[model samples]
Target: MTVIDFTAFIGRLATASGETILPFFRTSLSVDNKSSNDFDPVTEADRAAEAVMRRLIKSNFPQHGIVGEEFGNEREDADYVWVLDPIDGTKSFIAGFPIWGTLIALLHKGTPVFGMMHQPYIGERFSGDNGSAHYSGPSGERRLSVRRCASVKEATVFTTSPLLMNPDDRARFGRIENAARLSRYGGDCYSYCMLAAGHLDLVVETELKPYDIAGLIPIITGAGGVVTTWDGKPAQSGGRIIAAGDPRVHEAAMKLLNA
Candidate 1:
């Protein structure tokens, strides 16, 4: 089947995952630390949501592969793969912030062809297929687009947190933050989605997994923006990503990031 054929199915996945995760939001859910040296938090909600989506995918299309944050990969060599980050902003989620969202991406032979960021608490879903993007929720549905921003000095940038970055990377990112008209922390996947929606300018992040970024590439590119590594490679594999509404801004950020 063509990639377009998967649109409705993606909606179903988002809905199912959203339903599975909503009840745990802002609740006294138990969290587990996935990292011994750092605070990499994972909750039952993350696992449960991913489990629900994985089951649906396996039942509906047994031939497909799956890669998830909570659960490991399965049949990852298959032509079609689904990359999932059930709660892209688990830290924000546990802190009772609505910035968290469910990230789902479909890759065709390792290329992202479809992506969605579903924030159930806010009743919003941002979806894309490289060619175009759309937003649907309480505010109603509309096509998504990125606003023009030509320079870092004129741009608003976001990162989940500079603290998440190591010392060298943090110093590098400080250059952009210093030049940007505005810089804010704590967005996670929502920052990328907002960049896609024309509400923001650039999003710079580091140390992201495939599941963290695979689902966001299409949405940003589809909305007429650009997403890439700091050195200008494709971002699907996820590391030191810089996304901007304007290519000029992207170039500027890349130079700063690499300088």
Candidate 2:
């Protein structure tokens, strides 16, 4: 089936996952550390939301594959795969921040064909299909577009936290942060969506999984922006990602990042 046919189903997945997660937001939720060496937090909301989405996908498209952050992979070799990060910003969620969102991506033969970031708390949904993007929520619905920004000196950039990056990556990112007109942190998936919506200029991140980035690639590209690795590779596999609203800015940032 075509990607268009999956749009409604994606909406359903977003809704179901959002509903499953909202109640846990800002509550006295128990968190589990998924990493022994680091603070990789996962809560019941993350697992429950993913479980709901997984069940829906399994029942609706039994033949499709699934890759999730909370759970392990299943049928990963199938032609159609769904990548999910039920709470893309679990850190923010745990901090009682509304910046977290549910990330859903559909891969056609390993290429992202559809993506959406749904924030139920803020009631915002950002969706795309590589060719175009749209935003819907309390502010109403509109087409998503990136604003023009030609240079890092004139740009606003964001990253979840430089602390998340290792020493070398952090040093490279510091170059961009120092050059940019503004720098902020702690958005996770919401920062990428804001870049898609013309509100931001650049987003640079490192140490991301497929589930962390697969859903964001189409949204940024579809909104007339660019997303890629620091060395200019596709970002679906998710490592050292850099996204910018303008190609010139992207090129400029890439040079700085690689230098």
Candidate 3:
């Protein structure tokens, strides 16, 4: 199938997953810990949404593989793979926050070519292909592009938390944070969407799994932003990430991160 065909399917995929997720949004649903500690949470919403999306992919394109946070991997050697993070921000979701969203991405031969982030409660969807990006919400449809900033000191920076990084990385992050004029913490995947919308300048995150960032790369880059590993390489594998809406911001931030 052509990209247009897959794009149409992606729209439906997000809608279907959103339908399964909305009901559990603000409910007193039980949350189970997926990590060894009680902090990392997983709700039925995460699993149910992933299941619905997985079912759709398997039914429509059984040849494609799937890498999901909840269900694990299947048919990974296939040329096309669907990456799903049903609730990209479960911590915020369980807190009754609207910033949480579902993430979906398609990788062609292991290279991401399409991505979408959908927040059902907020009625927002951010989508992009390799060439362009767009936003859909109550305000209606619009194109997305990042704003230009000459330097990191003039930019607004964001990170989920310095705590997400190891102690050494945290100290390295502090150097960059100190350089930025403003630093806001804690938005998870939504922070990247905000950066693409020209509402923020930079986002640095660490120790993320592939599922945490697979859907965000396209949205940012298609909007004229740049995303890379802290060492100034592709972030496709999703470990240490630094994304900037402006290239200059990226250049300045990377210096501090790599220093």
Candidate 4:
């Protein structure tokens, strides 16, 4: 197959998602519970956003497959797939926190080659494909690259919600934080945006589905960052993820994880 122009498609998709998500930012959404815990919440906004994106994809790229957080999978055997995390921070969106956003990524043969993280509430879109990462905001487009946070002790660590982790996962993350300079919470896919923007160093988390990590791959890789499972393996298959600015930092953290 010819090289698909991912940058253009992702940018258009991001803009389309913005149109669907912006009005509902704080305008009273129909929120729902995904489980007994309020921390695992969902909203009509999530479904509606995914629906909007799915329609766009089906109309324009009918041959492509889609795996969406809300809608499950469609056409899994297609040569290319789109993974969509519509409103990744659903808990934040339900709580009116404005920290939520949509994540979109294109996978070619189970590998991410393009990604977009669109924060409609904040009017920011971070995207990359074809070996380039850029952010579109009020200041126009700016190139992005990960910062060289040389060591774990000097690195910034981000995990969206510690409450989402089990005891074993929490302990694993704690062992990591105990060696880090700073640890902060909030932002789901948006945290990866921070990493790609060079404003953050590392992101570690567990129990991620494909949609959760797919959208960060291209942006992170394009920014000259490393993203993988804790064992320093490919993240596209989805599991525990650790994204770092430096390869050395990644290896050191992986050692701690496997230890």
Q: Per-model C-alpha lDDT, please?
A: 0.94, 0.95, 0.91, 0.84
TM-score for each of the candidates = 0.99, 0.99, 0.98, 0.94
What is the alpha-carbon RMSD of candidate 4 to the true structure? 1.6
State the lDDT at 2 in candidate 1: 100
Segments of candidate 4 deviating more than 4 angstroms: 1-4, 36-39
Clashes of 4: 0
User: Roughly what TM-score does model 4 have, to 2 decimal places?
Assistant: 0.94
Higher-TM-score candidate of 2 and 4 = 2
> Candidate 3 vs candidate 4: which has greater TM-score?
3
- Residue 12 alpha-carbon offset, candidate 4, angstroms: 2.4
> 1-259 in candidate 3: lDDT tens per residue?
6556799899999999999999998999999998884378999999999999999999999999999999999998899999999999899899998878899989888888899999999899999885899999999999999999989889899999898789999998898889889999999989999999999999999998888888999899899999999998888789999999999889898888878
Between prediction 1 and prediction 2, the one with superior lDDT is 2
Residue pairs with backbone atoms closer than 3 Å in model 4 (clashes): none
* Candidate 2 structure quality by residue, lDDT tens digits, 161-253: 999999999999999999999999989999999999999999999999999999999999999999999999999999889999999999999
Best by lDDT: 2
Give the clashing pairs for model 3. Answer: none
Q: How accurate is candidate 2 locally (lDDT)?
A: 0.95
